[model samples]
Target chain A: MTRLLPVLTVLLAIVALWYAAVAPMNIRQALDMAERGGAVVVPEGSRVRSETSVWTLMAQNTGEIARGYALDRPRLPTPVQVGAELWKTTGEMALRGRAFSTRSLIYHGWITLQSTLFGFALGTAIGILGAVGIVYSRTMEMSVMPWAIISQTVPIVALAPMIIVLSSQLGIEERAVPKAIISAYLCFFPVLVGMVKGLRSPSREQLDLLRTYNAGGFASFLKLRLPASVPYLFTSLKIGVAAALVGTIVGELPTGAISGLGARILIGDQFGTPLAIWAALFAAAILAGALVTLIGWLQGLAMRRMGVRA
Target chain B: MDIEDVVVASDLSLTFKTADGPVHALKDVNLTINKGDFVSFIGPSGCGKTTFLRCVAALEMPTGGTLTVNGMSPDAARKARAYGYVFQAAGLYPWRTIAGNIRLPLEIMGYSKAEMGERVDRVLELVELSGFGGKFPWQLSGGMQQRASIARALAFDADILLMDEPFGALDEIVRDRLNEELLSLWDRTGKTIGFVTHSIPEAVYLSTKIVVMSPRPGRITDVIESPLPKERPLDIRDSREFIEVAHRVRDGLRAGHGDEL
Candidate 1:
């Protein structure tokens, strides 16, 4: 409980700041809306409102500041508005057994999760294979390592659309495939670097001990290197899963997908519903937190079974 | 080489070609370790004692001279699994239980599951770690961890055991206790042992033969054949014969250092 106090405090501070920022951010729009409704707002012209400082306008119209929190299209959604939208989309829908409905965040979250998990698995497999090759062969280390690093440098935002177009041209019917590929592309680098470091983590004395047993290359690897890399692999996996989610979300952006949290965010932006975007963003955060926490729990379980101390 | 000779090194030399210059880690060192013999190499730091042991285990290549273990080259003998080596540190895998660490070599060598279990149990009992086999290395004390490492080396039933300062890191009380346990272990197993240390009393207490050496173009200065009895106790360190052997080793070390000063 004591450990949780600091985190709770920081979260409270952030929420307070978010609530405070809402008034200033949406004040101009709120005043303009009030003027159109026939209320006499000081410095009523939209052009004057844009030119004047939001803080000064806010003080001049204290009565109008509360309207900022109730705007139809807020620049920054209030915490209560976001919380209400999140609950309506997720909790309320879940309670009504409509959690998987088209409008539900859970439905969109499940879509994003499928691609994220698929891409995570693909990236992990490629990463482990690449690490093994790099560790065993000098040629792979020299050839593949540079390209792996270079692959990460090409911005995923730019690459996502190309991948989508390329896969579609290749006659792939599944939209998830291109998204998974882009997700895998972003996640594989961390796994590769981490596994390479992990596979080489055994000490000279440990290697020498294996050598004394006359253990062959494969035997040594199975007995020593593979087991040694587990802790490192898990550490990389946490990072990889989070990156995969980001890649899936970015991939969702350019494709104009009709479902998924990323689509909700894009659609909310296009249709001028900041509340929908805020809800989807929070849902994405919750999903990322769940995925990372799940991996952490697995890591603890594996280490315990392997006889490693915490 | 004699029929009983387990390791025979004549004019064995190892020169490490560092970027700074060539370092003569071992210089024309000559020695013979026979079957069932406990030979300890004692010297100050940089004295090639550990290097020589590494050479016998085929972990290092000798630059010059003929060196053989069980009548074959060190590398060939290594492939035949003729020896088990214990390093200065326990070097047990943290991810494995004590029994599991002992089972590592047996698994690599493709021993049957039942036989591996039997060997692990036997070696754990031999090292007085019978019921603690399921415990991780970190859970055991340093002395127990080293004993478990010894058990690991013994599990394979190799005829030769090469230990490089296996107890160098322990406190004196722990070191003394482990030394006594090790001597009894050596007496029971009758394995040809190559031990390395810097402590004069440790070398005197542990070996049938103590090879004294010096650093800087590292080479042997003396080979003392101990006259101590096979059945010895920890109190033997205070005995006249033990002190005499230790004194000679000290003198040999001083003589090796004579040219340096």
Candidate 2:
């Protein structure tokens, strides 16, 4: 609880700042609405005379500020509005009808999560294989490593559209595949780097000891290299999973898929509903947090089973 | 006692080709180590004592000349599982418990699980680390970690044990105690041991034969067979014979340094 104090304090500060900004950001729009509503006909000179500072304007127009905070289409959603939308979409929608239906945030969250997991698995496999190649073959180390580094330079946002278009041309209609490939593209690099480092981590003495035992290449790799790489693999997995989720969401954007969190964000933007956008953002964050935590738990179990400190 | 040669090195030379130039690590090293002999190679840094041990373990190939172990080439002998090597550091896999580390070689050798367990238990008892089988390497003190490493080498019951400065990192008191324990362990096992160290007293106290070596194209300067008995106590380092052997080792080291100049 004590450890959480600073985090809670920072969160509270951010929320307060968010609430404070609502008035100033929306004050012009609020006054425009008030003028349009014919509540007051303000003379151009009187606007400068009435309020010298934003704080004073805010103090004088509490009703207008409250109106800004309660806007259906806010520039920045307030914490309470976001929380209510989150509840409405995920909790209330699910409780009212089919839990996995179009109205539910849970449905969109699951769609994103499914693609993320698939991409994560594919990326992990490819990364481990790439790492093995790099470790064992000098050619792979020289060639593949440079290419892998170059691959990351191409931004995923730029690549996602190309991947989606190409896949669609190939008659790949499943929207999840392109997203998963994008995720795998993002996920593989960290695992490759971490595994390479991990596989090489055994000391010279340890390798020599293995040689003295007449342990062959494959034997040493399985017994020594693979086991040594576990901690590193899990560390990379946590990062990869989060990256995979981002890739999946980015994949959703260009295609305008109407099923996942990305679609919700797109729809929210189209309809000017800050609530939906905020809800989707929070849902993605929760998904990433839960996935990372699961990986961490698995890492703890594996390290403990091996008798190393977790 | 009629003895059989367990290790034979004739005109053994190893030169490492570095970017600067060729660094001669070992040269013209001729030696015959007999079965059941406790031989210690005493030398200063870069004297190639560790290099010689590595050759015997087949970890390094001699650039010139011949070296054989157990009547076979070093590589062949390695394939035959003729030896176990302990390093300067304990080098225990941190991820494994003491017993698991000991069980490693046995597992690699495709021993049955029952056999692996039995060997692990027996070596743990031999090293007096019986109760530490479940503990990871970091949990143990420096001496205990080294002892566990020794147990790991001893686990597969190889006829030859190659230890390279296994106690070099320990405090003197712990070193003294471990040295005594090692002698008893040697006496019990009767394995042909090739030990490496820089300490004259440690060399004098432990070995049945002390091979003093010199650096700069590392070669044996003196081979002194101890007149001391096989059964040695901790206070045996204070003995007159032990002192005489120690003095000879020190003199050999000094002479080797003089030759380098």
Candidate 3:
């Protein structure tokens, strides 16, 4: 309860700030609508209203300021507006048996999640195998590690379209294939660096102790290096999973891909519905939080079972 | 190659090639450790005492001269699992329970499931850590952790034991108690043991044979065979014979420093 209070307080503060900023952000549109309804707003002309400071216009037209919260298409949606959109698209649609329809955020979120998970699994496998190779062989360490680092510097946004087109040219029909590849591209580096560091974490004494036992290389790795790398693996996994989600979303952004949450965002922007965009953004945030928290919980479970204290 | 000799170092030397220069860690060191002997290498820092013990364990290669263990080359004896080594720190794996840590070497050496369990139980009892095997190393005190480490080394039942400052980090009261326990353990096992330490009294109290050494091209200054009987108690340190041996060790250490001043 004590831990929860601080988080709740901070969230409330952010919402309050968001609500306060909504008045300034959407006031001009609200005033224009009010003027069209024959109400006398202080700024006579739309151009003058655009030039005027929003704060001054706000103070001059207190009655019309509340209208900003009620606009059909707000410039910046209020928290309550975003919340209602979320419920109408998710909970209300579920009540009408349309939760998995094209309009529902859940359907889009599920699509995004599939690509994220596929990429994450692929990236983690490649990363761990690469780390083992790098740790055991000098040639792999010298050759592959620099290339892995260089791979990350090329922007994923720029590469996503090229990957999509290249995969299509190779006769791959599945849209998810290119997205998952892009996600894996973003996911592999953190896991590789972390596992490399983790695989090398054993102290000199620990290694010497193994040497004294004359343990074989495979035995040493399985018994010592692998277990020592668990905490590090989890840390990297958290980062990798988050990066994978971003890569999946970014992959959806290019190519007018009309399925995932990223597509919903693009659709909302094109239709000029700020509420839908805000709701989709919030859904993505919630998904990322859930994935990272799930990894953290798994870490706790593995550590506890291994007799490691918290 | 006497059958009774467990480790024989003749004109054995090790020079570590550092970027600064070659460091002569040991110089023409000759020693013989017999079967069932408790030999302690006593010296100051940079005196190669721990290095000599490491050489016996085949953890370090001697650049010059020959060193043999169990009548074979040190490397071969190591492969044969001739010796169990204890480091300065306990170096227990935190993820494993005490029994699990003790079972590590046995598992690596391909002991059967039943034998591994049996040896773990036996060594835990030998170290008086029978009940604490289920506990994690971090949950135990420092002294208990070191005891668990010793139990881990003994679990494989190697004939030779090499310890490098195994109790150097403990408080004196804890050290004294562990010293007594270690003496009893050595008495029971009759394993050929090579211990390294800087404490003079610890050297005098525990070793059947004490090799006093000097620094700067590390070499043995004196080898004292204790006249005291095999069955020694902690109170034996207060005896006249123990003090006489300790005085001789201190004199040897000072004589090694004579050329420096």
Index of the highest-DockQ prediction = 3
Of the pair 2 and 3, which is ahead by lDDT? 3
TM-score of 2: 0.95
Could you give candidate 1's per-residue lDDT for residues B110-142 as a string of tens digits? 899999999999999989999998899999999
lDDT by residue for model 2 (A1-310), tens = 8879999999999889989888887665565566667666333234572455656666666666766776767777788988999998888877887778888899999999999999999999999999999999999999999999999999988999999899999999998899899999999999999999999988887888899899989989988999988988899999988988898898888787998999999998888887899999999999999999999999999988888764
TM-score of each: 0.98, 0.95, 0.98
Please tell me how candidate 2 rates in CAPRI terms.
high
Interface RMSD of each: 0.7, 1.1, 0.6
Q: Is 2 or 3 the stronger prediction by TM-score?
A: 3
Candidate 1 local lDDT, A165-270, one digit each (tens) = 9999999979899989989998898999999999999999999999999999999899899999999999999999999999999989989688888999999999
Error of 1 at A273 (Å): 1.1
Instruction: State how far residue A283 of model 3 sits from its true place (Å).
Output: 0.6
Model 3, residue pairs in steric clash:
none
Q: What range of 10 consecutive residues in model 3 chain B has the weakest lDDT sum? A: B252-261
DockQ of each: 0.90, 0.83, 0.91
